[model samples]
Every structure is written in C-alpha cells, then in structure tokens.
Target: MENELLGKFKLVVGMEIHFHLKTEKKMFCSCCADIWEKEPNTVVCPVCLGLPGALPVPNIDAVKKTQMMGLALDCSLNMKSRFDRKHYFYPDLPKGYQISQYKQPLCIDGKLKLESGTVVDIERVHLEEDVAKSFHEEGKTLVDFNKSGIPLVEIVTRPCFRNIPDTVEYCKQIQLMVKYLGIGEADMEKGQMRLEVNISLRTSEQERKDELPKYKVEVKNINSFKFVEKAIQSEIIRQRELLENGITPMQENRGFKEGSMKTVPQRSKEEAKDYRYFPEPDIPPMEFTPEYIKDLKTNLPPTPYMIIDKLEKEIGLSRNNAKTMVEKLGPSYISKFEKLLRMGADPIQTSNLLLNKKEYRNVSEEEIIEVIKNTKTAYSKMEENELNAVIKKVLANNLKAVEDFKKGKESSVMYLVGEAMRMTSGKNKPDPIQLKQKILDMLDSDAN
Candidate 1:
C-alpha cells in the first residue's frame, strides 16, 4: 500500500529535530534542570521567567553537548559560535524573543547513513534555549516558565528523503544517535525529542522539469514518528488531489490532526526575515579549542550502525534480525545477550527466545546460560526409548493436534512438540531437531 502511494509522487522530507541537552541547570540561570514530577511552577527562577533586571548566562555543558553531537554526525565544528534573538509573539515566549543561533551555529555539514544505505545530509546543528510550555483550557491559556530556559540543540537536515518509511527511519536513526551520545534521553513521550517535518512532492520521473514542484508544507511539533509518516502520507495525497483539480498547492504551516489523520493549515510559510534575527549583545562569542573537540570524540559512545555491524560480523547473526533485536533490547540489553552467546548457547535458539517470542521478559544472561546447560544435560541423560515414551504420552494427550498433523496441517506439529516439551517440564531429553523427528515417526506409526 505504501509503495503504491509512493509511485504517484516523489516525497521530499526534511527534519528539524530539537533535542534537550542533559544539563544540571537551565541554559541561562541557576534553576535546576531536573523536573522530577514537581509542582508546575516550582522550577522557575528570575532569568527563566524573563523578569526585569534578569541576565542570561550560557551553560558550558550544553555547549559541549552541541559540539559532541556535531562531531558524531561528521559535521564541521565551528570554533566560534554566537547567539541571536529570534523575534516571535506567543504566550510561550516569555522573553518575547528566543535566544537562538543564526549567523554562526555550533556545527555544520554533517551526514547520517540509514540502514538502507541511504545517506542524509545535515544542513546545520545549532544551540538554543528552549521555550516554556503552554497549557490551554476553557479558551484560556497558561504558561509555565519551568522549561523556558532549558538548553536545546536543533539539527536541521537537507530535504533529500524519498518516502514516508524513509522519513520514519531517519527520525529513529537520529534518536538512536542522540541517545547513544548520552547527551539526552531523546524520549518523544517526555518532549525531549521534538520533530518538525517539511514535505514537498515532485514528479516520480527524474527528467521531467517542465513545471516546478509544489511548495513545501511544514508540519510543526510532531512528537511521534508514526504521526510523522501519517502526516507526510496525508499531505502527499492532499497535494496530488489539489494538482489534479487544477489548483496549486500552497506553502504554509499545517498541524497534524491526530484523531482525524488530516492536516489543517496554521499559517503561511514564514521567511527568516520575518523572524527579525539579530545578534544578542548580552552574551559574547563562544569558542572551543581543538583539544576540546578531540577529548569529546574520545568519550563518544558506539552508534547504532556500529553496533549492528558488530552483531552481524562477530556474533554471526543476519542483518535484519540483528537490527530488530538491537532496537527492542537496546544496546546494553544486547550486550548481555552477546555475553550469553559466548557462554555456549545455540545462536538461533537464543535469538528466537529473545526476538521472536513475546512471553519472555527481564531475561538475564545467567538464566539463559543455565537453561541451555540444563537442557543439554537432560537430553544426554535420557535414553532413546524414554524420549520415545514421552512423545507418545504427549500425542495421546493432544489427540486433536495429532489428528491435525496426520491431516497434513504443518502448523499443528509445533503445538504438539510444544505440548511434549511442556509435559516433560522442558526436559523432553532431545535436541529440537531430534524431538521433531521422533514426533513425526510416532505420527507415522499411528497412521499404520
């Protein structure tokens, strides 16, 4: 279904990702960064609240995190970076203008390679202070400055994506990269990682250039990857219908209506001149030495791609299976699995129990090793006759599945084998291959 949709229009996707840095204090104030389920307004201070006579100070940890992210993405780190004021009018903007980087951002020119081997170029990565949260109820809106001055690193990517699935995978790759860097948790549920998707459609054929493509539509504040894909898909369909009806697509900001799976226009696209960006006088230009960048590089964690390669090459697992396992188990959890594999368990069985089943939970390396060892020991101890007897009892108990197997229902064999294993308390005393053969032989005898 997705490929059929992609066949109609060329999807161009660019992402603006806002990642909250893990710092102990607000960007320009002494307020605690840890928001730990406190009262709504308790974490605010004079600077964060934008009171009179308040001053702003840059957080060093936030700056370093921005630089580290730049390096991780293979971006050119700017030795000198400065802040600017982005003018906007909203209740969430307590200071009236957001202190952001405009002319000189911390990093520029980075690239990320997706699992599909497609490379996406990053336009730039800049450091900025976050805005406060807004709560609206009963037609009245309230602002909380608790999150106003938190440090944020915005990563802007080039508009090079081809499809909705590619866009979703790109977002996931960026989140994994940020988490591995230990700069932020990158949890979408916590608003730690926020996404703004820019989508435009072009002709599927590369050579047709008689007319330009539709104007890009921006979808703002998409918190989930699933919603990102849905928004793009809907937008592409909407634009296609507009063009087919002899109506041109408009350049505007749209909000993804989650419940309805449609997009509603918020406003027309705003240019940089509309923001009225200007350098801030209060803070001076910040600079970093080469030694600082080198030190940060040394401390960087292994990225998802690197881990995927190691899993496939060193552990002898298929690429698709490794990627699936790594995503669900996390890097640390996969490390524990690797340790168990080294202790002599069947690789395929371990992968199945961990990735292919839903019944397993909180599995430990020690427990896995013990289970494999016990199963091997039990199989060695039992004679062929004893194992055959166990299989016969299980077949007699599960007559329905046995009859289904005799009728050439292949799936029923698994249920019968599982019943046999269960009846013996997982000590059926044969390897899985051998156990299957014994069951087939018993079924053949029953037919005779």
Candidate 2:
C-alpha cells in the first residue's frame, strides 16, 4: 500500500539561477561593480540611476565573461545577439524596465550532467543588469543603487528535475564551474548567486506519458540550498493535499520562510506577455565571428568534471571521495593536493586529512607530510583492543552524544572521538582519523 501511494505522483522541478559576473564595472555603465561593503548609492551613475537623458553603454568585459560562461556550460554561442528591455516595476528597479536579453539570448541549448548521471538541459543563458538593493523599515522603504548596474547572468533550465538531490547537485556543479572559470564568487549568503525553483506534481500516468502539470508554483529568491530543499518538499506536500481534495493548485509566486520552513503565498505569477520584452534601442546588436568564438573556447580552463576524472584515474581515489574533495575544497586547493603527493604523502591519508581537518589546509606541505608520518606511527603502535575499549567507554559514558550521532549529527561523532582521545594520553594516543571511523562503525553496528 505504501509503495502504491508513493508511486502515485512524481515531482517536476526546473531552476532559474541568477549569478553576478565578477567584472570591474557594471553591465551598461562605467560604475564600479564591487558594491560589497559600500555605502548606499555611492556607486550610482546616471546610467544606473535611470535619470533623464541617461544612455547605457554596454560593458565589453561583461559580455566576454558571459560568453566565457556559456562556453564553460557547453552552450552554443550565437553569432549575433542583442539586448532587450524587460518591463517590470518595483521600488528597487528605478527604471520602468530592466535591460535584459529575451528573444535572442547569448547562449542556448547547454547542459549540465550531475554526478548521479542525470543530465539537466539548459534552455538559455542570458545577460542582464542587477537592480538596486531595497530595505524596508518602519512604514518606509530605502533604496541603494550600489548594486544597481552590476553584471548579471541568468541561466534557465528545462523542467527536467524529478528529485531534490539531482537539483541541488546541479546547483553545486554550477558554483564549482564559476569558481574554476573565475566568473563569480557564487556565495549565496552575500547574494552573489540566487536560486529560483518552478515546481509541480504530476500523476504517474502523466509522468509515463512525458507530460507536465498545468500549474507550477515558483519559489523565488532562495539564498541557501537547505532552504531550496525544504521549500520543494513543503510545496510538494501542499500541492499533493490540494490534489487529494479534488482542487488544482493555483499558479503563483511564493516565498520560503526560513523560520517555519514553509512556502507562503506572494502573488500571481507573470507570463511572457506580462513582461513585454523588446530589443534595447540604445545598444547595438552584438556580433561574434567564428574565429572569436573559437578563441574563447580554446582559452577555456578545465572544468570540475575533468578534475574529478584526474583524481579517480591518476590519484587512485574513489569516485565519491574525489568528488567530495573537489566540491568542498574547491578549485583553489587542487594544487595543494597535488603538491602534497609530490612531497611523498600517502594519497588516502592526505585526502582524509584535508577533507576532515580544516586546520590541516593552512599548514605548509612539509608540516603536513610530517604529521601524516607521525599519525601512522602512533596508529601502528596502538593495540586494536585497547583502542576499541576506549571508544566503547566513551560511547557508554556519553549516552546523549551517542544518540545524537545516530540521529545523523555527524559532528556528534567527533565529540565522542575527542572524549576517547582525552581518555588515552601521549604514547597510547590513537589516530584521530582512525578513531572517528571506528566510532562510526561501532555506532552503525549498535543501530543494526
């Protein structure tokens, strides 16, 4: 009965991600793009403020970066493309419409394949200018145009995501790609990269026939991946109940409330006609030759997928382990990992230390090599039964910590391991890495 109910409906999701390009100036003007930690309206100019007689001049560097990004995502670069004005009104948008690309975007038909082997199709990757920052206070609103004209790129994906894990992995891979290519920081907390999800639920028959639900709920401007996951799950339940009650869910825009982890109604969603998109008259159409496109492609750097392959084949690391290293440590630390290997550090131990111990990343290569040697020596001298006895004692003493570890609080296991280390002193000390793994093993056995 449970399996029958579970297979009754499928979740369909598509994502629109807006990321700021790390350019020196704004998209359409000569204003500073580094608006972080700047005063309100300090970086504004006539072009960004949308004042009378103000005209926009396209930033050549931003255009190049967008093309570079398109190449990185395996997108087809359009030989000739132009900007368009998208009509929208808000306190933050000083201009009646935003300068964005519509009918003809810079790149199209790109795809990103997740580690799980799910390929997400990219519908379009367009260029645009960011709006100003808005702050609402007591019965009043304030606007800062410092971020108004920063270079922004929007990546629109087809509605192909069936699960949250695949969706989140796709987002992480995009972040990794941007970092590797020096495009943007993609720091969600600082609003460098923002995520918007369009989700709906389909019946089993509809899914089998490759059909889409009529109504989709758009969760906009989500900052964290955790919130994205929660919002999707919550919206699924909300829509499912509506269907069960013989009512179709309304198509609308919603916001994710972090406090309660729920999606609340915002407004009716807009269609293409509502935006009233048109080509920008101020800037001329962009043209790229075959040679130019080829040059950009040839100068492109290696992607995360290439690095993951190297880790697996050359370094002999497992696929999952290599992925974790690249995803967490990022592109900056790839050289450090390679250098440590040249310094005679064991591959498995070096990988473990870098992944588990945050402090180990800051030390010199010589210091890291020495620590690995010392840890091995200490681990070999320790008796297996003695280490097990200490770990068991730690677990028995800290019942709450053990319970927390079982509940998926991985940090709790570290707390238990620390207690075991405290119990044994000096020459009898067990390797912290081995101690953590043994503790986890013991806990898993107890659960079974």
Candidate 3:
C-alpha cells in the first residue's frame, strides 16, 4: 500500500517451494542423509558424485513420500514420470545437470484453501535431487557435497496472490500442511525448505485497460517467510517507482539481502537456452502402478486447514486460537484438552493452563483431576464475583510489584499474578488482569 508510484497497480505473487524429504539416505545413493550437518564431502558416494560406471537408482521411500504429498494436496497423481537433466554450470552441481522432472511431474492440478477462503491453485509437484551447497567467504568459494543428491519435492503454485499478506499466509498455510502430512520437516532455518517468489504488477482495472503490462521480476533464494514478505513489499515499491518515472521494470532475478531488507540484482532472467535442459540419461524413467498410487492416498494425513475447521466447530474454539493450539500442541494433545473441557473444566481456563500457565509443572493429569475434584466442592459454592474479590485482596497486598506494573513495567504483573494465585491456594476465579488492576488501585490509595 505504501507504493504510490505505479498509479494503482495490482501486485501478483507466485511461489516455488522446495522441501527436502526426511529420509535415511540420499535419493539415488546409499549415503546417509545426515550429510547436511556433517563435514563437507564426507557423506558423498560414487553415485551421488556421478562418477564413471556409477548408476542412479531411485529411492522407493522418497517416491512413496512424493506420492503421499500429492494425495494430501488433492493433486492428480501421474502413473509415470521421468527424470530430466537440468543442465547448468555451477560449483555446487556435481552432475552439471540436476536430475529433475520436466514434461511429467509426480503431481499436478492441486488447490490449497487459505484462511480467507481464497484457494491458490498449484501447478505441479515434482521430484528432484538436491545439489551440494556452496559456501563463500573472504576471497574464495568452497563446495560441500554433504547435501548432494538429497531427495527434494518442488511445489509450484499458480500466480494468484494479490498482496503481501496473502502471499505470506499462503506460504505459512502450505508449510503447515506439508508438516501435517508428515512429508517433510519444512524447516527454513535448516535449509530443508526454500522459497522462490515470482512477482509482477498489472495496471488497475480503471487504468490502461486497453494494454497490459509485461514487466515481471523474480526474487530468488528467499529462505524465511519474513524475508519473502519483506522482499515482495520492497520489490512492489521499487517497481512502482520505476513505472511512475515512465520506466518499465525489467525481467530479472534478484536476491534478498536480510540485513538491509532489500532485493539486489542477481542475474538476468534466463530463457530455456540458459538451462539447456535435456533428458537425464543416467537415471531410468520411473513408473508407478494404480495400486501404488492408491496405497499412497490411503496413507495421506488430513490437511491442517481441515483439521482447524473441525476443531473450531466441534470444540467451540476460535479459529485462530484453535489453529495455534493445534499446531503447538499437536493432535493428540488437542484431543486430551478437548476431553478435559468436556469433563466440565472451563475451556478458556483449560486452554490457558495448557498453553500459557506453567503453574502445575511435574503434576500428572491424574493428580490434576484429583485436585479439581476436591476443589470443585468449595469452588462451586461461591459466586464468580465473590471468588474474584478474594483474588483481588490477595493481589492488593503485593504493593511494590503492583506499582511496577502501573509504571509500564508490564512484565512485573506476572509476579503479582503468581503471588495472588499462591495466596488464594489456586482457588480464585478472577482473571489475571482483574487481579493486577486491583493491586494497582490499592497501591494508588496507599500513596494518597
């Protein structure tokens, strides 16, 4: 919204996400997948390095995982998909051309629904082998083949996002979905998941309806979700400025600089000639039968969005809170919490106790049940206001700490709450905030 230069242009965003599979060994080799953290070149084998007389065999587990992921995303599973060579010259690529899918991908024609009820269509989900990582420092660059030949699944989405928030939400939702499906860890910090954003701007409906703009840009190697959001916002502003000055944004690749929160030019956008992609001769075409696809579909987990909606409707939880709780606590924990709520424990209180309050540490659920059973007799006798009054009195006596909270030292309120709970023997029915305010008023009266 800050970008005002392009005379009202609509921002469009698409993402290509690559997630490394959590497997024991490399895609085509027996070498361990632990190479990512190991010393450089130590985990590499002849097959991964594409040495002479070495042949590549597809990893069955990796293939099954890709199929399962496809099923979870509601994608069409291709019975057969062949590996192609994406030829390029880079220090990291040991084979010189990556073994990837071109014409035939593992999955196609999928859609993901966002929280806003918008569905982003997925173009394809393909399988490939990851290349080695290159480390550059000082004056030289070094190649680490430890990560070479790891199994990866690349998901490409259609250009559908209209703003920064939508793009971010889509990425986060997809990441969660991938995690829920048990496909991959999808950890951006560990390089297990990476993102590439393709962005373009079009003139608004009211402006220049006769001709559409052809200016487009690609931001590559955006690792973190925060960086993806920031880079898109920065690029939108940058392109708008250029267009305002009667300049069209050129088609090119840009790198995101985390420190400065800006995008820097990396290289010109390459056409098909740049990659020189061809059929991979070293690997054979992989085929899957109908039974194989059906087996994978049976193993697919429920999508995170679906789970969120069910939890909200069935458990009477807010959508956002349920999503957060389910994500943090996992499905098993959520079920336990729901059971406790059904047994007459207050829902909000139960949520807070499970998530925020750590007061009953080291106590088993059985012990909690026992305590609740004994306390309910005394607790139910008093009205809510009367129970809250006892809590307020306990917090009011903690004068010094209450003063700290009133002076904007808000973190001090925790100490007051803890003390109040202790004084009331955890029997008070008042909310934490009411106790804190009562303590502040007592302090003010004492000062007067």
Task: Say which candidate scores most in TM-score.
Answer: 2
User: Which residue runs does candidate 3 get wrong by more than 4 Å?
Assistant: 2-7, 206-213, 331-350, 358-429, 433-448
- Candidate 3 achieves a global lDDT of 0.75
User: Per-residue lDDT for 1-448 in model 1, tens only?
Assistant: 5556655666677889998988999898999997756678899988888887788999988998888889889899888999999998889886789999999999999998886678888999999989989999999998877888989999999887876767888889888878767788888888888999998777756416534365789999999988998898888788878766777689899999999988889988898999999998889998889888888888877787888788778876666556766777676667667777788777655765675444543666778766555644334444666777888888888889987876548688788777777656443445665466557656765765
Clash-forming residue pairs, model 1: none
TM-score of each model, in listed order: 0.80, 0.85, 0.80
Off by over 4 Å in 1: 6-8, 204-214, 338-368, 377-448
For candidate 2, the lDDT comes to 0.87
Taking all chains together, the TM-score of candidate 1 against the true structure is 0.80
Alpha-carbon deviation at 288 in model 1, angstroms:
1.4
Which of the predicted structures, 1 or 3, would earn the higher lDDT when compared with the native?
Answer: 1
- Looking at candidate 2, the ten consecutive residues that score lowest on lDDT are 1-10
Full-model lDDT for every candidate:
0.80, 0.87, 0.75
Error of 1 at 79 (Å): 1.5
